[model samples]
Target: MANFTELINKHIIVIGGGAAGFFAAINAAEMHPGIKVTILEKSNKLLAKVRISGGGRCNVTNHCFEINELVKNYPRGSKELKQVFSRFNVSDTIAWFKKRGVDLKTEPDNRMFPDADSSETIIDCFMYQVKKNNIAIKLNEEVLNIIRNPKPETQNPKLEVQTTRESYSADAVICSSGGHNNAKNYNFIQKTGHTISELIPSLFTINLPGNNIKELMGLSVQNATVRVEKTKHQYTGPVLITHWGLSGPAVLKLSAFAAKDFFDRDYNANILINWTGDLNSELVSSELTSWMKEKSLIVNTPLYEIPKRLWAFLVDKADIPDNKPWNELSKKHLNKLAQVLTNDSYNMKGKTTFKEEFVTSGGVNLKEIDFKTMQSKIMPNLYFCGEVLDVDGITGGFNFQNAWSTAFVAASSV
Candidate 1:
């Protein structure tokens, strides 16, 4: 049923069985019913990350209209992705998925998920499409090398992929190989002459060592500012003190944007938190002064309205005796206590992975790929997608958004 050209049968081989690979294979088959589509997955399973994404609910995409606005969410490959998003943006993805029977719902944070709130809903959608279009999915098939015949002036290119089991030739090759850090699935693709950027852990939580804040585990403060030591990149939003360390949306976003720097510095950093963000020192000084004389202070009693346990901890961090009355407090002690409460510092000994959804930021350089088609600008009949490119986003629906956008462009042009 495929075009044999002047040689044999037409086949399209898609490497990697993750989101981008699956989408590209399914869409390509649905488009050119004449061609045979095959998905080669190195591992026995597919969509392993997607299954665990968003704690298994799977954030499908973000609801951003402007291409520029959407691209900003990604720390790496922002410039190149600006072009990729222009081709197939969030609106197009919503319409494409909805028309295929997967209705999505958007939350206040712009995270879009299927109405069912289950990843099975998304997997089933892709599986059904693949089944309907006769897409062939091969698992446990690792591609060891790719061999393409050097074409003459105007002939269509033919590529052969050699696996441990067998070798298959195709009229086109879509390299949707994932990132290197994915120990199981993506190592094979890196052997094919593509430069893999320094692979480092990204989008992880920071663990504070030797800090007594572990006693305040599970306490969340809304609207706080957290700053890393010596850096102007202060994070703002909600804060959660965990048994391990700090977390919540604010810390998570900061971790993503500074992923590379943390890796380069060996996961060692210090954090300074303003329990109250953007509040002036004058207001804090006044507030602490007002609370000073209101009550008779006990040894561990806090004169502040902050969580009693946290206030006691801050008092310890301040190294000030708590039983002392406001009028008896020394001028030097007030400044020391104010700095401790207003700008407390914690040392980060290591990084904690997101556990379920871990992705690396470094991948094949984006400049080599044609953003218009996700095809190789350096080599024709070759394409790239998924995490193998230098594109990764903060947790939420952004990563999958890249998978959808890149694969759509590949399917359209290839």
Candidate 2:
């Protein structure tokens, strides 16, 4: 708990050169003008995630302004983020970027991206801020350990960061090192006595190996309900048939919320898809019954706004003759068709990372960190932000929003 005067001329070290790292370093230096801030990145490239996020557009933040509604997008750290967002929420993020001359545009789904439609716009903004603040960025310098220097009870402790090539000492250390898929990668933070949660993959697409659905790749339904069979997890949104399996916003959201469950099942589970979103068995039956009065071929008359190709596939799956007139459809075939439309089942054998956005559901346990300051409870002068903590959201700009908010808190605190 150093006062403002005590922090004058102090140094701060930020590990990770990704979205959170750059953000923390730049803000820390900008907030306390006398402090020297340095960023240590293990990778050669900086802002790697920011470069590929939102298919290269860099989803900056969600357009959601209400903290209550905005926090819903997060599956892991929604509770903690309630307090965090109160300090720096989506509106703050929008204003922060706008103040820097980067205007963000909202998509139909509320994902906010730079109006320029390029991630480079974000990278350029960060680089400009870094240079403006004189923040030092060292690439390929992997941080291996962080040691807190013993101090008198009256004074705040200092931190010494041990890295691959050399060591650096700082008045405070911000561990915005992003997330790692493997638990062992968090050994450095664990050595400092913070608990690392069981890491599991989140936000992935369901993989159906050897399934006929792959043949209908590139087809998508505007509205479909995908549910993990035998589990209560389900989401209704656009569902896409990919060459690998099923993907889309609904699948990605399901994967995020059920990450631990999917990991427990070893990614082997049955996913029931309702191509007709919100349509129950009775409703589907009614739709099929109403179509019986028509003389057109069943495949030729796609209903419920379903794509023609998918309608044909569903008709074939029900074993009904594609060319059979709707009026000549059998009772048994009608039941089968209703079932196929309302309750299509697929066995998911595995999962594919949703695009290049690899988000995980576990990290340093949230209980050990103060959301208000993004500072570690166990280690003095040590802070954490971004996915390094157990905070993640479903695809959109939510994860990035978490990064900005938590990084802002950590920077302002330091």
Instruction: Estimate, for each residue in 198-251, the C-alpha lDDT of model 2 and write its tens digit.
Output: 999998998999998799999999899999888889999999999999998999
Question: Could you say which candidate leads in TM-score?
Answer: 2
Candidate 1 all-Cα RMSD: 3.3
Off by over 4 Å in 1: 1-9, 152-155, 182-191, 280-283, 286-306, 324-329
Predicted structure 2, TM vs. truth: 0.94
- In model 1, pairs of residues that clash are none
Error of 2 at 339 (Å): 1.2
Q: Write the per-residue lDDT of candidate 1 for residues 48-102, one digit (tens) a residue.
A: 7777778788899998888888887888888888878888889988998899999
CA lDDT, every model vs. true structure: 0.79, 0.90
> How many clashing pairs per prediction, in order?
0, 0
Q: What is the lDDT for 62 in model 1?
A: 91
Q: Give lDDT: candidate 1, residue 411.
A: 79
